[model samples]
Target chain A: MNRSAFPPLNLRWLMPLLLALPLLVQAADPLPSWNDGPSKKAIESFVSAVTSEGSKDFVQPAERIAVFDNDGTLWSEQPMYFQVLFAFAEVKRLAPQHPEWKEQQPFKAVLEGDQKTLAASGMDGIIKIVGATHTGLSNEAFIDNAEAWLAKAVHPKSQKPFTEMVYQPMLELLAYLRANGFKTYIVSGGDVTFMRAFAEEVYGIPPEQVIGTTFVTQFQNQDGKLSILRTPKLAHNDDGPGKPESIDSIIGRRPIFAFGNSDGDLQMLQWTAAGSGKRFTGLVHHTDAKREWAYDRESKVGKLDKALDQAKAEGWTVVDMAAEWRQVFPFATATSGQ
Target chain B: MNRSAFPPLNLRWLMPLLLALPLLVQAADPLPSWNDGPSKKAIESFVSAVTSEGSKDFVQPAERIAVFDNDGTLWSEQPMYFQVLFAFAEVKRLAPQHPEWKEQQPFKAVLEGDQKTLAASGMDGIIKIVGATHTGLSNEAFIDNAEAWLAKAVHPKSQKPFTEMVYQPMLELLAYLRANGFKTYIVSGGDVTFMRAFAEEVYGIPPEQVIGTTFVTQFQNQDGKLSILRTPKLAHNDDGPGKPESIDSIIGRRPIFAFGNSDGDLQMLQWTAAGSGKRFTGLVHHTDAKREWAYDRESKVGKLDKALDQAKAEGWTVVDMAAEWRQVFPFATATSGQ
Candidate 1:
């Protein structure tokens, strides 16, 4: 074969084009689950501004921190938070060990499945249940218990795994932001250990990236083995103003973008907006009674009255689930059909 | 161009080899400042075991967490911790505004440059100095004050900038671990804000990776501007057992490798060592009195007594500084002939 008969295939120029083609093909719609609306437009434009080099709003990759509220923002919080359900289940599971719980009000209510009595018991009762169930175990043991429960547990209303109840549009948004160099974080009211179990798998957020309400932990050396023991005391709540406090303490940088669903996230939104740059503050307004639960403002769980007003006044993106989302859960097709 | 007279370049076969050649050449000794010794050999072998695929001790890249103690382990902590020096400088800088500080014991001692009286003031006086200087300012202001002091602050004996006092061998080790897919973190007895000020520039560890002692801070909305206000109240003292506690709280994973120089880091080392599989724990023994301060059990600052005993008993790698390190500070040549 004469070498002169063959045309030179320039591998240097051709290889890069070949490699980049697949990426271009894969990067079709970053927010496919999102319906074309003001909510999606706002998100897209904000990301574009921050990521584009030479743009006035461009933020360095290191400074592109994006925080999210977990309970209502990322996943459904209807019928009450999923972690509370886990706590109630835990109380029932440990009932056999605690015979005294058969007499105690909240524990008895939990064991007997008396929802009315448990609801009537209020914050004190919830704290008592959390303190009992969430403490005294090694952190590894607690994580194991939470993971085991999450493995099989189903959401009562949706008849799906709790992890499956994550908002598809929001999931798309998280991916979109991350694709644009934003570091996604879960700044939630959920306990750190509990959220850490599912966050990594479900949301692609790592354990270190999840900041949440924390309980005091002690280092225990049992013989040669070591364990972190969870104490009953609450170290940080990570709700309301506590969100920004924990964000500053843990991340040591203010996020340029924040998303939330209730009054608990108001301070976080306010804090993010106060940064001197082109920032994005968004709220997930529960406005679809059909696909998902729609109660907000007057609802006991994930109340959005003050924050809703602020969102409207500040021109922040308020995601109208009914109109803005083409899909609800990851398991369901567009509109969920259920 | 006469095609019959030319030969094919075979670029396809040539490109990859050309790209890989530089990498091969650049991957020289990972720790250049580390002398050929038991300590360096132990580190190299442990890294090889964990990073090698199919090795029984191999760790996944995400799980390769390495924690380091900042004060005596990474840099010189004597004549005293650099942060304490900054605090003393802050007192002097702010003394003119506080007329009452002239009569205060610790403040008067600081202002008068009375080392004996200041040393006599002990921890309580030190706390008073820290409370006055480290808190009541916004986190930004506190960091600004710290950075300003660090920029000009020089070690008394070494007469080098405090940041330059970081151990060259340790810096090389940190970079080496990071190169092999390990995430480096500073779990130090120093305050998080204080350490974060220089961690990224000095040790290549980011702010989020620096876990340390923290004072309580409040999220303040001053009109439209937001700031995290440092409060005087002690939130968590990240020393002794607190080291492991904070590591678990922030990182949410057990470190496979840890380095320290004092009893304050003993718990962190124990925590890392207790993790299942191949682990590395190290301590820097300050035996180089001519080059650096040498003190162990009897030293008030950077005490190494208990931790030295633990390292010996646990078979942890202890770097005998005088023998193991070819260089101490990055600014100096092989021997720092100060």
Candidate 2:
């Protein structure tokens, strides 16, 4: 076969197209669930600036740390925080073991479905409930309990599994940042172990990257086997000022990007903003009562008054859930909410 | 240009050789600094079993966690723990600002270079010294101070920077483990921030992978700037049992591989060994007196007595440094030690 007989392939024309394949793919909406609004634009602009090779705002891959609050930001936190619901459920689950709980104010209220009495018991009651349900078991056992609870529990309004209630827009954003070489972390106010049960599978954030409230553990060796036993002692609160404290203690670096929706996350956003480089901080405003719950300033769970004000004052992106979210939950169909 | 003219390339014969290329390359010694001995063999076998596909002991990449004690396992801790040495040096450097250090017992002893008095003062004195030099500053300031000290501090015996004192064989082991899909972490009794300053540069372990003793930090906002201020308060004492507790709290998973050289690391090794899989626990026995200091049962710092006996009883890998290490420090040459 002579070389001249074969038609020269016009492959030169395909070179530029092939070279721009990645860019073309990226040109497609990275966050499809995010409506074309300030929230989406702010995210894309921040990510692009940080990822562009020669841009002044470009950050090294290792330093591109982005932290998001688990409750109210990544997932809905209304009808009370999910972790509190888990704790309340635990009181009822363990009520059979503790008959005295039927007489105990908090436990009795939980078992009787009396939210009024439980609310009246206050923070002390909440602490008591957490102590009974979260401690005095091995780490493995506690994780097992949390995993079991999450698998079966559903939101009262949506009737979807707790993990299924994660915001679709936030999930897409998490994936988008990760694809651009950013390490996404959940810096929440929930218990570390509790968030860890569903985080890796649902959000793709690993156990080591999930920083939150922590409890003291003990190294216990029985005969030849060893176990880490959880005790009823608070190690770190991981809320409000505690968020920044844990960030510094555990992550050892100030994150350049932060997302939250409550006053508890104000310090974290402030800390992110106070960094020396171009920083981004955003708050997810609960403004959609039709698709999701919409209580902010007056809501006991995930109150957003201070942080919402700060986001407006600082010109931080405040996501209007009603207008900025094309879809809320992943399970919501176009006919249902989109 | 012609299929038949290529003589079929004899490609069938080359297939076997091509297929075996990876194995041939892997056959090269991954841990070149380790002598052909039981410690090296044990490590190779453990890594092989856990990393080999379809093996009953094979662990998922996400679960392949390895923890190492920093003080004596990765680097030499003779004269005194390097962090303590840094504390003493800090007392001297900050003596001008801390004029009262001249009158305080521990600070005075550190300032005067009075070893006998310092030794007599015991753990209380050490804690006082650590609190004074390590806390009451912002996290960034504390880290800056630590980094500056590490930049200039040298091991008294080797006359090399403290970071240079990291063991060559241990460094090779860390790399080998990482290459085979293991996440390596440093779990030590040293202050987390102090270890973090040089760990990433010297040991290739990042700050997030380091779990150690911690001080309480408070989030402070001055005007519009935010900072994590280090409080003079003990958060967690990461030694012995504290090691396992910190590992559980921070990593949220039990490590499968652990290494240490002192009683402080015993609990960590036990915790790793207790994980339900093919696990590895190692102890670096300080048996070489010429290349490095040698002390076990009677040592004041990094005492290996209890752990040494436990390793023998439990059949954990005990590295006889003088016999097993082909080279000790990276700076050590053939003329110096080989």
Candidate 3:
């Protein structure tokens, strides 16, 4: 039965060979990239707690919901949120058609390669850029443009394509969680539609499970045909305290586990930890400067001041990427998917 | 390996076992309650198409979304929509507060037990009843009222509690699809938050995944405290074409599977069918007058005219309640959670 591996005769790694054979191939050290440390142990313990049956830690099948913050947590969020970069690229691509964009503030920054002005735009400028590039399009057009832009866009930091910047350990964790019956959701502050464009191929999270920022969309009668219009109105933010509210509004049930990267995700961890029983919260602190950029407390991209203090106070697990992960990026590097 | 049961050339199902000890539980038969026939084969083929690895029929993990219309499809929408009954009861409950409602259109019909007046009131009366019974109260207060009323009230026909009336086989199907990596959403024409109150406890479908008709919601600054308000502005109507629009806008992916009982569900079924590959669409025809009640085409509640036609023309599976399902309601009925 291969039950001898676990000690105390109570911890069984494999369920009884039930009716249908298991679907996944048990690989070499599943998530081999995750480093050796308490962070790993914390993840294993939480996963086991909710998965193992007939134990007090055993979560019911229905309550086995896990939420992940997408940016800086599951994938990379450096220099800027990837969506902003996509918007800039989108503006650049449309520059020929929109000649007046060169005279515009945010659009001018995008066109002139004036990275400073774009960065200086900060939150408001980013919103302006996103709204400008995102509007007046159909769902198909948006997906097509996003796919085209992402195929060629590289991260300013790693100098690798944007998709290559995803954390390898987190990728395995996603697969592992799905294997153990947890419905994982990317509850991020990023636009749900934008993330949905690639999440399926990247994280294996379906569009329906992604709860994030959104905009108003309308149905239009276009040339005697019905079409969907993506508008610029703010729908849901899915950040800070909004994270908890979004989880309540979108997921309905309190999850048994939550994961995040920075202070923006502090409230989400708080919400998950506050759940009734067998709760787990883990934070990914960017600390691998060699393989990937590392920063904490004072980083502009994924600031961690509030969440750092809260995690330490509450005894939440803080994953140090440099020491805790053997590999930072997936083996599918810049050219792998190609 | 005991692989003789499956064709040797078709090793997709067995390969996982050799590669990894897949959890091999008999793929949960979602339609176990239904006797084997075209209905069962149709369900199996749909699951096979979407779940089998690498098949063009292979729906991506992100696209593995299924939606169900709640009233007639997930449960029972008969005699009248459940919400309609709730409005009638609400008139009686608030009778002590608003005795004037006794002279109102729908309220008067409900109070006087006059079906003629209720029909005459029609759109105007229905809107008045919905607005009156649904708004201006705290979400918690409304849910509490629903719970109390649900506990005490009985259906006009069969004298059974409304909670006892949900279809049991559909519940199994919901659990089954979820087991096979499908995200199940209750896309109903009912109130989103209202149905959300009991949906989790009743259907195991969480509120976030419940797409339904919605009203305008506002965050109000109430004397230095922030409280949310739900207004009757008719935000999203999740019926007919509204179902597909809501699915695309909220979920961002067309569903691979859809189910419903009436013409109200025809558009949703069409939406699912229009998705690329390995799709499943079903119509739940209430054909059992013995176990439940058979009414379609001309039935006042949950008429199945268009859907029945579409089911035939488009080769969609139709669930004849009388012949297919072994049971119609959850084993435990009334008194406690459905």
Candidate 4:
């Protein structure tokens, strides 16, 4: 137990090689893309509090659970949900069957490449498009379709593949949590199975830890084979208060810490607050319009008004994107349509 | 990292003092009550595999995720589901306000303490009883009511509290897993929050790692005050393939190891087998009819048909409860139960 939990054999020399592989993944100076300020201090403090067993705020490894909202919080959930863009490409490929879609409002707008009309359709229009595109498939089938799209699809702004649009600093945050013994979960408004498609490759959070909205599914025995049929019934919505509910349903305990962006995340933060004992509730504010699009009270996507007002009062740390993140997406990536 | 994660630095010699404290727990050795044979082998193989880093089956501290089923898997789920027992008690307590319950079949049976009528009514009848018992309550209300029932409720056979009905071998299994860098999770069909109420005391597993069925909830804000509400909604069912689905939806990885007893757990065992490289799935077969119940295939409670068949086919380890477990429940303070 003292050394490597293994005997001091030459296999020990092999152990350092295994550990070195991950260290090589990090730059010589870790967190090179982090903005220098209290924002950095805040992140450092939270990590230290949960990691330092000797400190007053020390938490046991078993109790260290940290949850994050995907989409805007992880990558750019701007212009449109990246998954929506994936759905659009899928719709075009499947367009041969749906001749009627050529005349439909959102579908016609999307097919005609009119981003304005598609935007005008709003959340209602988006839901209809996603449901139509994602339903009528097995869980495996849906995952394959999403993964295929990610393999080819590029972001509108970052020009990189949607997976590359992931925030570099947030990636650092995820690794930091893992290094500190925290189990991380991706609780998002995105489709559960859809996120599961590439969440492992992108976030290092496995399919099992991705909690999101689900289409209704039915277990069926077909020709002595077991299969579950997928339908467009709203199963679980991992949004707002549903975040905490889903956490309870899946993880079964109130998270010691939570992070999110927008009013859609307000309920989750509040539910986290009701939990007794030392807790942390942090919100990611998308306020870098220069580097990244910024909108709060007036934005349709990832609206952060109610959460902003409560952040200061609740003493929840609000990370200012422009001031906190030295970089958004990885430098290896380039802007969209570049 | 070699030293204890928790140290008595400021209070010197505190570790020695703490170690000297009499452990309140009983049956650290799981041989006295466990029946014997394969059940013992299953336990042994699991501990040996995880602890042996050179065995090629060795699991790293970070990758060690172990899942266990509740009810029949951890404790006896006979007569009826244990959670149902709790629900039945709560239903009766609230019966004075619901006059219609007297006219209902299961409720009428439950209220009158007529075990015969309740048993005769069957699954449909049981569902009716559960719905009547579990709904119309807040999350806090449900948890408080459950804890109250647990405090007073006793097993008819043991005459001790139901909490004491936990398998002593399983407690040792949990501690052993943690000792080998594994995080143990109780994925049960029982109410999610309900299990968490006493899991820390009963199982070494903390509340956070427990996953199960859930109710819908709402976050309500009154002026500046906020609270969450619980509603009757099917969240996730941690049974059958649902066990694997829940594991995927919550844990974020395919556990390298799993344990369960009934046919209800066959899919979970299969899921564990599909894990990459090093994997183990242990099935606890209840063969000790003298001490417990021995019915497997035909027994409505804890039916083990699919799992027994699969264990043979897949070369999975099948543990015989009567022969393998040296002890079952913990003894009262002394080496024997009162």
Per-residue lDDT tens digits for candidate 4, residues A1-338, read 34235332333344455556857855444465667666567777777776776888887887687888998888888887788888889879888899999998889988899988988898888888888888887666777898889888887776778888888888988887787788898888898888887887888886667888876675444654544456788877778877877776566667787888888888778877677667778888888887778878888778888888999887888888878777888754322210
TM-scores for candidates 1 onward, in order: 0.94, 0.93, 0.75, 0.81
Candidate 4 similarity to native, TM-score: 0.81
- TM-score result, candidate 3: 0.75
Fnat of candidate 1 is 0.65
Off by over 4 Å in 2: A1-20, A334-338, B1-24, B334-338
Query: How good is the docking of model 3, as DockQ?
Result: 0.21
Q: Which CAPRI category fits model 3?
A: incorrect
- DockQ class, candidate 1: medium
Candidate 4 segments exceeding 4 Å error: A1-32, A45-58, A96-105, A219-229, A312-315, A332-338, B1-65, B95-105, B177-183, B270-282, B306-316, B332-338
Order by TM-score, highest first: 1, 2, 4, 3
Which run of 10 residues does model 3 chain A get worst, by summed lDDT? A10-19
lDDT of 1 by residue, A139-237 (tens): 999999999999998999878999999998888888888878889999999999999999999999989999999998999988868889999989999
* lDDT tens readout by residue for model 3, A100-190: 8879888898889998997788889888888988877876688778888878888887678787788888999998888788889898998
- Report the backbone clash tally of model 1: 0
Worst 10 residues of 4 chain A by lDDT: A3-12
Residue-by-residue lDDT tens digits, candidate 1, B1-338: 56455554447776557657858846889888888889999999999999989999999999999999988999999988888999999999999899999998999999999999998999999999999999999999999988998899888888889999999999999999998999999988788999989999999888888899999899987776778999999989999999999988999988999999998889999998888899999999998887776888888898888888989998999988988888888887656321
Q: What are the chain B TM-scores of all models?
A: 0.94, 0.93, 0.87, 0.84
User: Cα RMSD (Å) between model 1 and the true structure?
Assistant: 4.2
**Candidate No. with top TM-score:** 1
| Ordered list by lDDT, greatest first | 1, 2, 3, 4
Q: Is the docking of candidate 4 incorrect, acceptable, medium or high quality?
A: acceptable
